[model samples]
Target: MTSPSHHAPGAEHLLTRVGEVLKPALTHYLDLHAHPEVSGAEARTADRFGRRLAAAGCELTHEVGGHGVVGVLRNGDGPRVWLRAELDALPMRERTGLPYASRDDAMHACGHDLHLAAAAGAADLLARLSDRWRGTLLVVGQPAEETLTGAGAMLRDGLYERFGRPDVVLAQHAAPMPSGTVAHAADRVPMAAAGAVLDVVLHGRGGHVATPHLAVDPVVTAAAVVTRLQNVVARETAPADQVTLTVGTVRAGTAANVIPDHAVLGIAVRAAGEASLDRALAAVRRIVRAESAAAGAPREPEVTVASRSAALLCDPHTTGSVRRAHTGLLGPARVLSWPGSMATEDFPLFGDAGAAIHGERGIPLVYWMLGVADPDAWHRTTSDGITSDGAASGAPDAAPPPAPNHSPHFAPHIGSALRPAIAALTVAALDRFAVT
Candidate 1:
């Protein structure tokens, strides 16, 4: 639906229009934020999104790939453009004090509130601007991103098969940066690839705390394994190759007197590319089992990978289009060309099969980054609040986003973050579809 314009005409009119159309979408976005559903389980959320898209004139599909939703709008034939919105929320408690903050443990702390809203807004805007261009417009509301299964699930469930693949694949992330600033890096390394969650179980006999010598302490063995796991990255990976092996969680003995019979360690491995990822995973398991055995534990540690993802390789053409779009919409100075993130994104897998399609046919697939950092208001809101643990330590503010995207407190100025994202999505789709 269209709305009135307030600012002066021209670019301001366009901006105002985008915001106006996005108001309801923003409300929906906030509503989704207040009631976030977790990954592999976005049934209700998916239904809500489907209704909205269907109401907005998108041909809707539900449960496409375990709670995934797809909305297709076919305009006069041109180049096909695909816009992706992640529907899953992280398994984090809402810490943002916004009135619309998520009431559930699953919160849109990753700015996905804005992501999905922008997708909705983009769909609405593109529908309105249908006279401009396009072969087809596909708005994808992918689920289960937290577990990195949604995108892969969509492809497996025939995302491309059911709905022909696009000539250009474009998706924008809402940055927490200053208002009106849009940044894009061309053919730069997109998000780094990641491997499955590694669950390691170390088995040993339990004994009394005072008579520790009498029992095979799994805790001690697990501790040794944790300390030595660092060597997988330090000693095994090449010095030049970027690889990270972190044993983030460990569970063992409950009481000081009794040694537990079993020890468990959870790890996440990040690699610059697939080769390094495979190498690191192999080394990590080998070390875990060896360390357990050497620590006098008769049972070997069991290593298992729960999920995996390939690195995000930015399609050169798509990256170039994003760069030009940013340069055109926001200007050169406002466009910060930084390196891509090491974090993982399932988006890259869409083009991985190398199928005969648009992006496969040589259209560049670009993932644009919206700056969500360096701004004072956003920084303070997202990075300043202290956690319950930090509050106990007498600090009330949270630590700055060690990075963006998965932090529970990573909040963005939605009003400011939304405009550029909408404009970028709208402009990118139009630009690509207008090509060829």
Candidate 2:
């Protein structure tokens, strides 16, 4: 029941043929990048993938949870494997000075473009290898990864109920690390649990500049709450456990003379464990209430927490498979330890409880950091060569490449950085599914 077009000439030929196959894909992918779309608003993007996957003879389901797409390919009675790629773009203005850099309001700063291309390329490769593999292949194009809502929404909307859950789920993210390097560890926690929002509006009386104690002064209370919230991480939790409490934004009075009637406090929290997170939230509530009361505020502050993401755990079995596959193909030098990260990914919600909470079903999350930053310059500056002044490596003339991730001027070495990633993930998928 397979298409004659799916009969690829040679699986080994993919290594050499990848470039030609990817050229058109890369163009299309970059075009999508140019006109990036945000989460829940990816109708056009999802439609594009729907057509692309259908043309390749893969079964397609569109509009899953707003703008998500799933492509299914069944090959006899082999194990079911799930491969995912995020389709949404960030709200960032493009700064990468490339000919194909994003021109639209939204940008692909996180390299989801690479992820989408790799998934499609893998689909093409696996479609060709259908004769060699068994079981079902589910390639998912998920949306709203940046907003941390897409995956969770899809699951809630019956992704497993409709498509049937996979025995093994695999997803890869493009990182700003080294080009040829892959990061993996047996017990890897690629991202932590995170929550953020603007809440806790403090009410007070506005007064004239000459007023001494007429105004409640919510701004003063907010400043105190910010200082006290830090104690939650410092005093409540153990020194070793990682937790973060930050006040990113605060808004209050307009005039210096008059005391403002109201002020708003924005809070953000991150933790590695659920228990710790609960404790952190409790502490936030306690601080807001007590501080407002102390400030002699009349009414209770309205508190609300908006965005939330659970901690990401890498399944040992899958992580081990990825490590073995990566090391076997790229060698130990290129496969480095999974450098710990404070950032968070919502991918953890994919795993069911008691799945290993840390095991493959438990972790099912393997995040590899692809070294995209210039290694030569990094090595020189990091080494004990020059002072902190103008010169490191005793070479004041040397300067590092543009900053990586979140920097306005950051640029990726597309050919060197992206090609190796495609190769690594392709080989890793083949290894995981025993396709080759």
Candidate 3:
């Protein structure tokens, strides 16, 4: 939930000095939120970020990985700290009735719009206060993160070779937590998870519904596959291993009177470790193929792991430094060390204290959670004890709990999330890029 109109902790002077940037950041945020773009198609989004970065005193480079934007600020070059923001939105409809709600089919349900504006605001603040620290601050707007391909695409396109790897990489994600607060998971592996997009297609012979056994029902096979894969995580995986298997969609027949020739299903698999992920995926393949074969499908079913999200690991040193800095700024109460979730993110591709791109390790990654929920909404959920996923934990609930990321109803409290987010990034950079 939104705080009572607060300034960032221990950053009153700097916040005032760079206060002008927040207005433009708000404008940028609204603009981004209102006109969303999908992954790999963020051309205009890249342009918007590029302009903002340039205004923030960053040297801009475009098209690193399809429309990725890189903004570099060199100040006597001590440590190279990289701050990244996602440049893409989801393909969900914007149901929020705010005046600035997106009119397009796409939506910023994940709060990337806020993250982009925050990165811009931080760049502006750092550039204005150039005397505070000495380092090369690299601000990057990464594309295709929703599809879990942006980081890999950027890496393959010389992201490190051309720009050089960072000494420390920092990022943040918008969470359903109370606005004006932040969360970290330093003790546990913060946000380290492997995820994959699984797509399956089953081929079968079609026949009229009147036929008894004339058709090899791929729909039945798909149903069996879906039902069987549910046990991959619960029954197969070790109790300690965290894993999730979700069958998002399944499509098959055209009508109740006719059996379709083929069926398709989309699945998502994620886990904190590679072994858990591997086991789940293996189970998926086994179940899908086995079900299809048993149903006497026309041919071998198509199973694809469309995308594999990189597992992210935060460096203890870098994460600790950020934790300390944020704790000092926002206080220990506002800054919490929360547990990690199964949700996947592409930010992990940056590596943990090393060069994950070039095979040699060099850079460390640290990503924290920024609360964007409206104060009233978050409090309503807390008072009523809402589930972590923003679902009401109790029955007979008045309404579904506060919306979380990816939900069409998600509307971050930009007024409260923006300033603190900017401050958090600015302070994190200042902490790592200490005055030389």
**TM-score winner among the candidates?**
3
Mind giving the per-residue lDDT tens digits that candidate 1 earns over 303-344? 878778777776775567556655666677666654555566
Sort by lDDT, best first: what order?
3, 1, 2
Candidate 2 lowest-lDDT run of ten = 1-10
* Candidate 3 local lDDT, 1-436, one digit each (tens): 1211122234535445557788999999999999999999999999999999999889999999899999999988587889999999999899989899999889999999999999999999898888767779999999999899898898888888898867888999898877767877755574647889988999999999899398888888888888888888769988988888899889988799998899999899999888778878888999988988899887999999888875677777678878777776777777866577888888877874224565647577889888787767666654464344333455564545667789998999887778888888888887777463
Candidate 3 lowest-lDDT run of ten: 1-10
Writing each residue's lDDT as its tens digit, candidate 2 over 29-96 gives 76676777877788777877666666556799987777989999877765567778888877778876
What ordering of candidates by TM-score runs from best to worst?
3, 1, 2
Please identify model 2 stretches exceeding 4 Å from their true place: 1-14, 103-105, 188-198, 205-214, 251-261, 353-365, 374-398, 434-436
Model 1: residues with Cα > 4 Å off, grouped in runs: 1-13, 207-211, 253-258, 353-363, 373-403
- The per-candidate count of clashes, in order, stands at 17, 13, 12
lDDT of each: 0.72, 0.68, 0.82
Q: What is residue 5's positional error in candidate 3, in angstroms?
A: 28
For model 2, the local distance difference test gives 0.68
Q: After superposition, how far is residue 188 of candidate 3 from its true place, in Å?
A: 4.2
Root-mean-square deviation (CA) per prediction: 6.4, 5.6, 4.7
